[model samples]
Target: MKKVLFATTALIATAGMAAAEVKISGYGRFGLDWNEANDVAGALDNTDATNITSRFRLTFDVSTETDGGVTVGGRIRAQAENRDGAQGRATFSSPQFHVAYGGLRVNVGNIWGAIDSAPGLYLNTTSVGTGIDGMGFNSLAIKGAGFDTFTSAGVGRGGIEAIYSAGGFTGHVSYSKQNGTAGTSTDANGVERTALMLNYSFGDYFVTGAYQSADNGRTITKGGVAVEADDDVIFLAGGADFGQFGATLQLAQTEEADSVTLAGEAEVGAASTVIAWVNSTDIDTGVTAGQTVTDGTAFGINYEYDLGGGVTFVAGYVNTAADDNDNSVQAGLHFSF
Candidate 1:
């Protein structure tokens, strides 16, 4: 209660002083999905999840700039899954706030880190396709069910991000530590994850590479049982354009101990298409073989229409196949105001 009041007061103060600019923005989308399964392995089963599913995002921002190439900004956002669940209600599940200065960004509360240049923070877009096939390295096909990358569905501590971009070289690093609720120790130790990226662009060709690492332990049982694990993700991508035709290739791999994803996207006229595949072999470290799955593939195509005004329409479909047979069809519209 006190924290929320303080935040609201700060916003009001910003509005009352200087040239405070306040902007309210949000977007909503809904889609129906059909699923088919051959070897049901996940919770949704092979049954068709046919229903009007929607997501809502609301954002508030206040920003100003100095005469010396310095800028300061603050933002608050709320996202709701399954619109019918709770549209306008205050849900503690989706609340994030942050303040930033120049190239340094400080985030408190709940936030997700962005590292993958091609994927970054956009792994769960309706147009982003499914599994390792749709958007390849940019897809959230790997996030656990009912898990939100930002704060682990509020089952952990808040997240933080630090980023800097200069000249042709840009770099970003982020970290997140999750701690369970006030009463339970379910996710007590939580998970510690971090990502770093470096990118450079020149003329009609651009290239970017990134690495991500995570340590998942903190909540393991006794008897010296070590559920703590680590992984190294590396990405290398480049793109070139010639007149009306352009092409892009992205290759990413992780220590075989985890998984590897390779993907490519091409732009022809106003349309772009993506094809990707992934093979994840859990380093049994001690587990079993057949149980240590590996084969997974994804293919997709996307179309875009520029509406002149800062508005665009994007739609796509993806087919994903893996140890657990799963598939989904999705599309979305993007507009900026």
Candidate 2:
């Protein structure tokens, strides 16, 4: 990341305000992605199983410190991505504004929800999971849950959140509301969500717990159809580092399903590392009677070689738990400034 000092002479002279600081940072990644599922026949068929995947992102962070020792800041990002053969136009995201004092911080707009911010919730991979683009993030315990993270485009979750950290303990809470079109109770798109997360660390070990509830059920599309959302979810994760090796166990339960993931990372030599994870999900068949839901396990492995100067070579393979047991592989370069 690089920082720039803004010329705020006018503000300093007229408003008696401190000069604001701006930081610019981001990364670019491109790779080849091969998916066996894409090679299938029928409506989902793809003549070419391998394709290019790439993303370019730039983030701007602006902040200023007040005389009262409070810091106010906002973040916005511009990003574009190409997956398979479909390319997305570059777009700027809505700003996330924040205020901080001491160990407490509050954020509004495009907020990152508590569950998404909890430690150990994501595996240590190139982009937080198996591949450059997380290989669909099948290894996550909350793989199918609707949670908010930092959005790179569009008006993400318009939420408000508070986070606090002191010593080895951290806590976060978030709330969001989305009012879509009105409909029946089971098909309503209007929803409200509240999430909370707590974490504690001691020595080389850390544990985290998070919970989220959605009122009116957040709407999500499945199999090209909008479906009822999960009403609530609970997540728990624990991890520890032993020398150059680290491992984490995470569990997530929702109104209709439960999932567990075990992930590990190991350092090899001085510039190489390997990360792997296994995830299993079990759905309550009775609840999803008409839906095509299945219980299965997925696993993935990722390898990275550091080339210094914020550059790395990354490769990964994943075997999904779908009925077909499809698989994928990816290789690429990732760089940040």
Candidate 3:
């Protein structure tokens, strides 16, 4: 309570400040979640959770500028678990710092890579997809849903990102490196990613393309599967709005290559998942020297209606893993502030 009061007072104090600014914003939502087995023959079955989905985020946006017309800014945010989960205290997550001048900006710390933030790469729906945060039935797909390229490494290491804009065109680039190595298949000893994205918005339509190389990549699945590899992922997406409705479509592909890196994931019968639900092999790739690849394709589409007042109705379906023909459906009201 005391901290809240102090923070409120500080916000009020900065409200009228010109060279500096402070703002707080976030979102909240609740809904049902249903999941089904990917393979009826598999022991894994269907599950459902009702009336219990919610998340709260608090962000402190701060900025100031030197007399030279250059601006410096940063954001500090705290997020709780996505479902009926509690936090003992605010978990300040994804802190980022930036320097800006005209149309160019450079960022560092807790940065999302280019493919991760690329426009059109993912829909802007509040309930991004049918599965909340892609941990539900959507997980059955190889991509595990969304156009997310989020790195688990966070600032356990650090990252640098840059953004630029001119007229209707924008570009983004990012790089990050992780410390420590993996055993046979835990977190990698190191992880590196380089990404680039370009976007253009014209009239009522927008187009975007992105390329990313996940180097020394590391990922673990809910089924206790792990893989460390270098990924070459490319993405293209676009969206357009006609009157009150909007639609989007995206296509993504991963390059296939021999293993300089190894893949390990739980073997559900003979099926071993490559990353999340991203790719799999029916036959064991072997615990060691397995050649894993996610080469087919992943795609998504969604539609949304603006209800105004920071609220919108959203519904969408996704083929989380294109190779498996995995899909999920969701519809919900999203609020933004």
Candidate 4:
């Protein structure tokens, strides 16, 4: 009787151990940055600028496989940022929820855009003016232009998407809608908006194209004052990887203007470097936006070091110049787990 009881207890213990698993992890970092620009509009005042900024992230996840061949899992994340109280915000950021089943992944809540990728899942050091900073997705200004094609850098704003991956090939498609108050239309005049984007990735190559159109209107105050304005933008990007390096190029054109970006990066040890050039011109390329890029170029390079246990050191530099030209500098650090 005693031997039988011990065997039953051991079996129950083994079953309990196999039933659940929990993981907890997070990371944070803080540093300083500076910027100086010549002949550029809306540039940050990085002169004599010094402060401490940090990012914190936490993730909880669990997975299980049924008696059949089905598997299911879910994860949640919370991110926080701070900047020596000078910035006055400790907002939680990053993809908030994620789940996967078989070859499909359904990001049901706040999540990183499926289309966004970088060397270390950190920032973008491309655009001299408004790139993704060395810590996250693409330039928000560029990606947030009321478009439905790019999966958005972070958060759905409220939407749905489906993705499938088989062997080394993958494909995805998504749709979303947005609305807003008066006088705040970004792509158009009013606030109603819709976006569509599609893409395919195989092996070390990817290609994506997207389109966005918005409702917009303006009030002309006299004579036949125009009361509305309509706008739309189309974007395309493609790239390929060659083991130790990769390259990507982007083009964005709107009813009123167009811009182009060329980006590439290489990996070496614990660090990687990135460089990009952009040129923006109005519908008429000859019309100068004053010293700004009727035809311009920007370049940047970044080095990253993982300090173990979820800490990272990131340093970067950027220069942009148009005919009249402007140049600037930016560098900082970030941490997460």
- lDDT top scorer: 2
| C-alpha lDDT of residue 302 in model 4 | 59
lDDT of predicted model 2: 0.83
Tens digit of lDDT per residue, candidate 4, span 1-337?
Answer: 5335544554566684645334455555555544343224664454233345455556555455566745555555555655432544433332334345678765544433333321112224332223224422222213213333222233333445556677754555443344444576555522334444566677788777655555543222222333212235566777778877777777766543466666666777755454443333434233232211133444555566656654455665555433433343345555553
Instruction: Go through the candidates in order and give each one's C-alpha lDDT.
Output: 0.48, 0.83, 0.53, 0.46
Clashing pairs in 3: 141-321, 142-277, 142-278, 142-321, 180-189, 181-189, 182-188, 182-189
Ranking by lDDT: 2, 3, 1, 4
lDDT of 2 at 228: 51
Separately for all candidates shown, the number of backbone clashes (residues 3 or more apart, or on different chains) is 4, 0, 8, 18
Q: List the lowest-lDDT window of 10 residues for candidate 2.
A: 1-10
TM-score of each: 0.66, 0.89, 0.65, 0.61
Clash pairs detected, candidate 1: 133-298, 156-179, 157-178, 157-179
Q: Residue 63 in model 2: shift from native, Å?
A: 0.5
Off by over 4 Å in 2: 1-17, 43-47, 181-189, 218-228, 289-293
Worst 10 contiguous positions by lDDT, candidate 1: 139-148
Backbone clashes in model 3: 8
lDDT of 3 at 99: 97
Which digits, one per residue and each the tens of the lDDT, describe model 3 over residues 206-275? 8888777765554433223444334556667676766434555556544322111111122223311112
Local accuracy of candidate 2 as per-residue lDDT tens digits, 137-251: 8888874557777787687778899999999999999998765644535555556789999999999999999998786664455455555554568999999999899999999
lDDT of 3: 0.53
lDDT tens digits by residue: candidate 1, 220-323: 22234433233455566666656555555555543323333443444446643333333333333342221222444555555555555545455555555453
State which candidate has the highest TM-score. 2
